[model samples]
Target: MNGMWTFLALMMMISAQLQAQFDRSPWSFGLLGGMQRTHFTGTFQSLPGLYNCCKGFDGSSTSMDPFFGGSIRYAITASFGLDMQVEYVQSRGELSAVNTIGNALSFNGSGFDIVEAQSAFMMSWTIPSLGFTPSLAWKPFESGFGIRGGFTLRLQSNGEATGREELIQPKGVVFSDTKSTIRNDRKVNFTPTSLVYGPIIGLCYDMKLSESFTLTPEISYMHILNQLIEFSNSDESLSMSALRAGIMLSYTAFTPARLVEIPITPLPIIEIDTNKPYIPKRLKAKLAAFSVNEQSKEENIVNIVIEEYSSLTMTPLLNFVFFEEGEDKIPARYARLDATDTPMFDIDFIHTPNHVETYLHILNIIGKRMIEKPASIITLTGCNADIQKEKGDMALSMRRAESVKAYLEKVWNVSSNRITIKNRNLPEKHANTQTIMGAQENRRVEITSNEPYIISPIITLDTVRTMNPPIVRFRPQVETDSVSTWQLIAGQQDKELRRFTGEEKVPAFIDWHIGEEMSEGLATDSAIVYAFKARTSLQDSAEIQGMIPIEQVTLHKKKINRVQDREVNTFSLVLFDVRSSEITEGNAQIIEFIKGFVKPNSNISITGFTDRLGDADANQRLAQERADATAKALQVKNKAIVLGKGNSALYDERYPEGRLYTRTVDVIVDTRIDN
Candidate 1:
């Protein structure tokens, strides 16, 4: 049939198409619809040998009908797959015949009984067949196009057959012939129920609409192989064939067994945790300092290794905490502090609370490295920042270096064998580098490795040399590097006293021993300051500054006079403005609380606190100044201790009211002590 030729032609054209397409997955399914024409074939069983009127394939026997249904597909591999479909394919047929035939009476020999003839007849057959078909399909290439074929079980339901004959009798045989036709209303018929088996074949192109859907266009053909006619008194059959080209739209639940891969680069792993004290991002940047641009081909990050870091005194990459503007002796009060990139000296910065904190943190980090690799050693090379020092510079640098070495051994319990300290004090070897920026560089202790370098072990001398010597060289040191809880019972936050040099339970305070002459007849208890320090194990030596609290006065009363009655009074001072450490003249009324509660011998304690604002260091300094000025304003002749306990949770900085609460000093006085 021409239809078969067209189907084959379509197959040939599309099979060579650009297979550039969406990937087909393992399974898919969708709907289908299209149209087809049927070609019928059958014979009359009544005659047993003759073909029926509409039995043969011709112009009148073929009809077009709708086709619709759904399909499913399974992909076995990249290029091979199987598919199946169920669809509605049906055709209706009608054949009619009308004719006028000449009837002659040849009466030359025969009498009047010879001439009875009919000249007109009419007949029709209506065949409407509905079918439910199923199919199996496959594709040999890695494309959406494929071929499918299977059986159609057709139930021919509505069919009819009818015929009529007419006679024309003229008044005289030719002039007035009466034309008559016998009419039949219900003519052609088919068996109400009959199973018709047939084969169907199609060329379908499976097109993907999206991940889960597909569309298919097909050219399909089928032949009904069974006879399908049931007329009373007539055993006739109609075998039908169809040539159809249909476009079916389908949706498939297609899931691919493999997906296109995307390349990814893993980020370098560094430990980060919210709950734990962590290396801040700034510190990480400093630790990962690169001398080269990011676009460069060279790898800039030095691997962090325990063995390399454990054997060297790592100078903190941080600048030294410098002494305050004028006075120095660590602190004349608790101990004034100074900053240095160098290790702590037994001589100076050990007394500085800030310097002590910094030193502890650095050591904790170093100790952490050493702890990770127990078979490691650290070398400490200490140098003073002041290259201009004519005297005691070398001694000062050596003392600082030795202090760090001793700390690792004593506090962290690292074996002294794992650490070696060296003094680099020669002016020729270590210069002041005299510039402000360079001066801090000299103040810092430099570190070197007995093992290999990792983490780009910072390589430089503690002091820059005035002149280079062939015999002496500056070595590299790998420096590997807060919730406040303060509840004031009196003027001080009651804290557990920590030991600086001993294992015993340290006393709260030791007497100042300023003696009777210095008392100025005020009869005040001399204040004594106690050195406090707490040591603990660390991966990197870490101490949150606020974790351990300090107070305005920690010294216990002398108890020389045991007055049984101890009168206690508490007052809140809210006189200061934001970022200001001065008490205003209008707020002099706050001093009245002090005057009312104090005995001449009362050990007055004044502590100033601030809201959590700005940098922590600046906030703390402001607090201290405020407390001192408040004490000066009170004009207390007795021994008075002023403390600045930075920020307190007593106030939430989120609102003005909470911040006002924090911007106050708390005072507690006991009038019961004997003067």
Candidate 2:
């Protein structure tokens, strides 16, 4: 576990270093040549017969001549960095000895000495946050420092040897024929802890260099204890001290890191019936009282029921209401707490946990999408229409819009600075339509924009396989009436569709009759309709397995220039029996459609249209809702430009009641020229 933690910490350190390595700062990197002075202190009694090895000599604390070396620095920001340095140094100490009782005898006069040398590598960083540099001088007030201890190898070189002297009276000297080969010896401390620490201090400096580089000169010091120890015939203790100074040069490249922004919105809502009556059997001892709809023939109140376990009855029971609309206003008069002979009634209202979670999920998706595409514009419309219609007032709509904007600004990183809300009056068609299904489509928020954004996958089946060539279809501007069609097939064949390889001219398969069954003006008046069969093989069975259910349609529109100004329309589908904005089972199918049909760098024109099941204005809004939903899905897939229209102008002479079939989303792809 310790090793694992160490490895994890190392990885985290590397990651942080990489992330911060590119931060913007005034940086300089250059070779530094400077001098450092060191001295020894502490315990010289451990070894005897060595330099500074007298029997009672204390530790020597003395300064030595300065040595030369170099250093390098990488400043991560204006205040922090990694600094490495190395230096070569020499140190020394000495002691004197005295001889006794040789008035007439001869003796040699000499002194003992030891010279020490070492090389070291120290890593440390400077803390500029502790103080600020003076403006006029370009020097820091104070800089903190950190360092790693270094190792040293000791060597002993005997300078002088003392000779024995003869006494004046009656004493004869005896000589032996033995010589010593251990005149000089050295020792190396192998343990890591043998190293000592040094003092770290703040710095003040001035920086100056060429246009692309800079130079910073700094000073730091370290102090070590226990330098003099004496062993048999030798002294080994060594105290350490250093004063270092150097200049640093650096070249900097900075890639800034900024927080991403997310744009969040409120969840679209649809109301369901919450009105019903309650009854209980075995009405013993007036067990509980019930409430009913206040406006109805009965009263709308909370009902409390309790089953009798035995003769004893509990006086209090808990009644909880966990689901309530956010905008609901509970009236105090409606709080029926009656303690009559019949029993008492009380009401409680609360929001379900599921409801809150669902709303948060919607807002999260919006925020994530916004972060991915920061410059995109988002328009919110159509919420609170039902409340306004019911009350015949526009205040509800305004409140809804403001609430949504607030949620986005507070919950998401998106600032109110970028958001724009338009509180539109209810369309005349929705004046009195209140069916549950109709109201479901009415209580929605539509997102829209005019900018051309990509709304398709970066890759597709055609880009991967060759068996079935993809088909490309487009509708020119309805007002311009310059429509075109073409087929891209793999294996050549003489039939309904044509094939094109590379930049060959786009083949035209003119079959305007396929749309004859569609309402006359529905395709062009409100929106354009374009559909194609997925190209399949007759012999190969595995070729079409697991393919997208519908052929993905790519649109290209033409205006003035054939290559530069066209817009591509994003196409999508809405599943039945579910709200348009909710993420349900149908979402997978929507993704498939984008993958099969949309392409990168393609622009689209999406016109929303609805069946005549609801009033004209309501249908128009529903169409817009579908358009907005399609655009949202497509935006996730890739990029696109989307426009929403309400009801189709196309009409049918026969089977006029079947307008629902005509309700569709039209996508026009542009090669160039028109937007």
- The per-prediction tally of clashing pairs is 45, 60
**Model 1: per-residue lDDT, tens digit, 543-656?**
222221111111122233342333445555663654677675434655654576667766678888886656889889988988888777777624777889886666444433
The per-residue C-alpha lDDT of model 2 at residue 377 equals: 61
**Global local distance difference test of model 2:** 0.35
Residue 49 alpha-carbon offset, candidate 2, angstroms: 8.4
- The local distance difference test score of each candidate is 0.48, 0.35
TM-score of model 2 (CA atoms): 0.22
Candidate with the greatest lDDT versus the true structure: 1
Weakest ten-residue segment in model 1 by summed lDDT: 304-313
lDDT per residue, candidate 2, 1-675, as tens digits? 999999999999987876765455443344554545544444433233322222433444344444444444555544455554444444433322222322222222373233221111111111010111111112223442232233323332222222222222212222122232112233322111223333344353545443355566666565544332323334434445656665444454456666567888988998766685442222111011112222223322221111111111001100111111223221122122222311111111211112222222333334344545778666655343344334443554455555555655665556675666665445333323455434433433444433223121111111111111122222111111121332323211222222332222222332122122221222121122222222112211111111012221222322222423322323334332222333334344544554554445445566566655546777666677766666665563245555556555443412211232245454544333323
